[model samples]
Structures are given as C-alpha cells and as structure tokens.
Target: MMFLRYLAAVPLIVLSCAGVPFGYLTLSSYLFQRSLPGEPAEFDFVAGFVGNVTALAGFWPVPVAFLLFAGLWWRTAAWPRISLLPSVPTAFVGLVTGTGWAIALGVALPLVSWGLARLAARIVSRPISGDVRRSAVEVLIGLRGGGRLRVQSRRLLLDRLPPPRYRESPVGRVAIPFDRIGHVEAGVVDAPAQWRFGNTSELTITPGPALRVIGSGQEWLVPVDDVDAALRLVVERAQARAKPEPRPPLESARWASAKKLWDLGEAQLSQTGQRKVRHGGHHVLLVLSVLTVAMTGYSVFRVFTDGWGFLFGALFFGAISYGTGRAWVSAGATQKLAEENPCSPLADDPDPRHRPITGWSYQPVVLGQTSDL
Candidate 1:
C-alpha cells in the first residue's frame, strides 16, 4: 500500500524537474556575466567547474521533492529510525536532482545533522534505574548558551556538546557527570537585562539564573522548573555515589588547582566596575538581523543599478534574517513560561557554595522527564 502511494506521487515529485534548467540558467548568467578580468587560468578552470557542479547539484527542487516524500514516509512508517534511513539516499538523489535541489539540500543539511544527532542520542541512551543515573526525564538540562532546557533523565547523556567519538554524529552530547558535582545553588537574582523586553509596564517575575552545579571549580547552569527540587536530586544522586575513600595526592592537587581558578572567577565577578557584558543567543540573532537589514539596504541600492535580480535577492535574504530573530524571541518566551517563583529551598541561597553537596534533606520528587530529542 505504501509503495503504491509513493508510486502515485512520483509525477508530482517530478515537478521538481523544472529546477534543473532554472538552476543551470541562473548559474550560467551569474558566472558568464560577472566581469572577472586578469584572473589566472587555474582560477578560471576551477571557477567554471564549481559553477557547473553547483548548478547541477544545488537546484532547489530536490529538497522540495525530498521534503514531500519525507512527509509521505512519516505518515506511513512505524518507526522514526526508518525515516532517517533515507538520508543515505539523499546524496545520490541530489546528484541528479539539479541546482535547485542542491541549494535546498545545503540549507536543510544542518537541520538534518541536528535531527540525526538527536536520533542517535535516543537510540544509544540507556534507561534510568536506581542510583545509576541512566536517561532521566524530569531533569531539564541547559548549557551555558540559552536554549530550551530539554527534559531528560539519564545521569550522563550527550547534550549540546556531544562526546569526542560522536563528533560527526551531531547528537551524542556529553553531560556533566553527577559524581563530580559539588554544589547545587539557586536564588532570586537579577534577570538578564535583555529579558526586560515586553514588560515595560507590568513587573514580571524577576528571571533568576537557573539551578547551577559547581563541579571541579566550573559552574553549569541547569534550567528546570522547581530548580530547588532539581538541585536536591542532583545533590542526592551525587551523595549516593560518594565514597568515603581518601583522595590521592595528585587528585587532591588537581582539586586545589580547580579551586584557585574558581576563586579567581569569583573575584573577577565581585568587582563591580570591571564586569564583562554577556550576550545571549537571542541578542546575537537580533544584532545579526539588524546587520542583515543594513546589508539589504545596500542590495536595494544595487537593484537600481543591477536589476530585479538584486531586488528579489535582497528581499528574500532580508526576510530570512528578520524571521530568524523573531523565531528565537518566540522560543525564548516559551522557555520563560516554565519559570516559577524560586521555591523555599532554592531561595535560601542565591550564591552557589564551593563545597560538594552531601546529605541533602529534601525527599526526591519524581517529576516526569521529556523524551523529546
């Protein structure tokens, strides 16, 4: 039945056939019309070869066909893993697919990498049982950079930063080990200044820094609801794994070294006049969007001298930049929705302790964890 459905869609998929000629023509015009005088023979040969290849490979229709077929497969396939199997064929599909397909694939390639990485993580991640920190569901892990604090349960799992071995896989992130965790701190702190947007009149809940873990003198921010509870869980988990065995001289020395760095960081942070400005992901996107608008203005100016090509290009590119900024802002807002008033346990200490958490008093709360990759 699925095969018959795919067969029926073959003709519509072939509508992408128009992309081949369109891509070739666009590239030929761009390459031939551009005035490149006094260039070396090697450079010309390379440039011509690249142009031909790009036109043949990058044609936008290929991705449209792929996306269409992907939707078809998604509806019929029982397992998500099966859907990813098609990625191997994508390279072959793009080769004959044309310039439009190639360009579309290039754009989607990052999302593809990210998707595969997440999928790989799901496949390899083990289930949580007892004190062994397996894949966790309730724990919302956030890295230094701002992103949605994805809920997971594993004691150690790949996050934004994948392990060295899965470097190309894009999904296997190495999480901070609970065994090394020394401190879990939370408090009502001043929210980042940029978060002050859209709340000019009403006093919004002061967004505090999320639960922080101090380990080996470094701090990791964990964005989770009931941050105090999460802190207790981490502390409890760490304590459960703690051994009374004495530390080796070398190990103690490394701890001492890490302590010095931690103290140095604290001293720098305490100094009011010499503060470094922090920029979140949203801020970066907003800045880039503004810059893109300025660049678009230049392109618009070029349109008067060049043609409709520059005009259309500038509009399309400009919209993409603006759209990215808007999208990031929306995502940030959704993440903020999870924020709650700092619970009593967390509110007790805004400043994270340098010492390792041991013998936590609070009972563990079994909050549900998300399996979203």
Candidate 2:
C-alpha cells in the first residue's frame, strides 16, 4: 500500500520534468554555446567541469523537485536500515529517472522502488510500532540536512518571534522551503496587507532553503510558523495515539453505512490491482507516452522566438502526461485504501505514530503516529 501511494505521485514527477527545458537551456548557455572566458587553448578540463556543475547547481528547479519526491520515498520507505539509500544515491536516481521519462520511467521507477522498499523493510527494518518520531519528517526539511527532530508537543514559538502580526493585519508570512523561489503572489486573509499565514498560495520553488511547514498529520506541504508550532501541533495530534475520541451514536451509524460502501470499493479496487499486475497493458502505453514527452521538449524548442502556437506543444504534453497518471498508481494502493477502511480500528485517526512506514499516500509527512498514513 505504501508503494501504491508513492507510485501515485506522478505530479511530482511531472514537476521534475519541467527541468527538461531548463537543462536544455543551461547546457546550451553554459557548455554548448558558451561565451568562452579565455582563449580556447586556455580552457582547462577541471575548470570547465566545475563551472558547468556550478551552472547546473544554479538552475535547480528540476533537481529540487526530484529531491522532494525522492526524499519522501526514501525517508518513509527505506530509512534506518536503508539509511544510505536516499541522500547521494537518491539524487542520482532522480536525475536518471527525470531524463524525459516524462511519462515512462517516472511511473515505472515508483512501481519498482515501492515493491523493493517494502520487501527490504520486511527483511532489514523492524516496525517501530506506535512510534511517530520516525515518520517522514526528514523528507520535509531534512533533505541532506541532518538533525533529529525532538517532538515537543504543545510548544509554540509565538513568543520567540515578534507577535505574529503585521500592523493591524494578520501577517501570514510563509517561510517557503525552496532555495531560489521567484514570482510569489500571496493573498491576504481579511484584506491586502492584512495577510494570514497558512493560506494556499502558488509557489515557484527552487533549491536552497524551503520553508516546508508540516504538522497535524497533514501533507508535508502545509505552511506553519515554526518547528515549535510543528511540534506542538503534531504532538497534539498524536498525543491521543493511545486512545480515540468517542463519536456520537448518530455519527457512528453514518460511519457504519459508509464502511459498507468502502468495503465494496475495496474489493473492486483489489480486483483492478490484480488485473494490472496480471495483464500489464499499461506497460506498453507507458513506453509510448515517454517517447511522446521526449518529442514534446524537442518539437517546440524555440517557444520564445516561435509563434504562440508553440505553446500548444506544452499544452499537449501536459494533457498527455495527465492522462498517463492513472497507470502510475501501483496495485499496492488498493491494499492501502483497504487498510484505511472504517473497519480498521485506527482508520479515522490521523496519528502517524502507529504506522511503521507511511502507507500508500500522497506527498508529505506528518509528525507522530497517524492511522491515515
């Protein structure tokens, strides 16, 4: 199920694919059509390689996107025993996978890795049951940055910083966790200048420093104030891991009815998963899709100089890529959804502390043992 969840993250794959154009441009600008710094005879191999790497580092939209995707999988899936799997190797793997699989490799790699990680976990890693501390929080900010996060429940940083308000407005300053972000447009809650934190805003994320505010068993992408708030909110969420809140009889009846529907859906989903694993029709389709995306980057290279019609190439690429996403969801997702069915004792709980690995789910990590994981 955990594998299925990661497999479903094709959007992240597409985001990384955007690097295709950037890589093209960077290479063209730096190496291929470079303005040589000195006479050709003076060009040193070591200097050239280092400079190229630096230029590549400067254009990091693709790598950062892939890093997020890889980190999520590595921390939640591999971890501990697979300690060395993610950091350097994950980066290299992401780069390899992002090479215009635009459709093919993106889907295939997730499916393959998901299975491997699970199998490895069963062998090398022991489930730290009821343990929330080891959740994929590392995926959020600890990408390459190392330090254990000590969960301090109920700790707030409102006092550590200036009162969390700007003038009369509720200043919602999102410390986005990207290194080189551009063109930010944030909305104010009450009015302009009267901003609020945590509002959903479009982010143009690049590598350096991203302010990923994860907490309360939500996806790793939520914007929070500080780690203190993260600890407080996350711990508050999982602090109830040992017990559950009693729902009213009416709610329970409604939940029971929902459970019946969920069970039926689960059976159908399991069948579908089985069909995918058995028939494998999508494998061929995936190959075609990858070829299509590679063509997309090539077909309309001169978007800036070419007429507006070139934009259609990008649109076509997007539509085709979007269509290919369903094939990416692994069969394990069926089991994941089934496990989270109402029949499960922890189905309604958001505490990640209870799960060993983050089960099949979308991007991000919550602090603590969550049932939904």
Candidate with best TM-score: 1
TM-score of each: 0.29, 0.26
User: Residues 97-196, candidate 2, lDDT per residue (tens digit)?
Assistant: 4444333433343344444444433322123222323332222212112212222221111111112221211121222111111111111111111111
The local lDDT score (0 to 100) that residue 149 gets in candidate 2 is 26
By summed lDDT, the worst window of 10 consecutive residues in model 2 runs over 179-188
Q: What's model 1's TM-score?
A: 0.29
The TM-score of predicted model 2 comes to 0.26
lDDT score of residue 298 within candidate 1: 72
After superposition, candidate 1 runs with Cα above 4 Å error? 1-98, 102-110, 119-140, 143-177, 180-209, 212-223, 226-229, 232-373
Q: State the displacement of the C-alpha of residue 138, model 2, in Å, after optimal TM-score superposition.
A: 5.7
- Which 10-residue span in candidate 1 carries the lowest summed lDDT? 195-204
- State the lDDT of candidate 1 residue by residue for 152-171, as single tens digits: 33232213321212111111
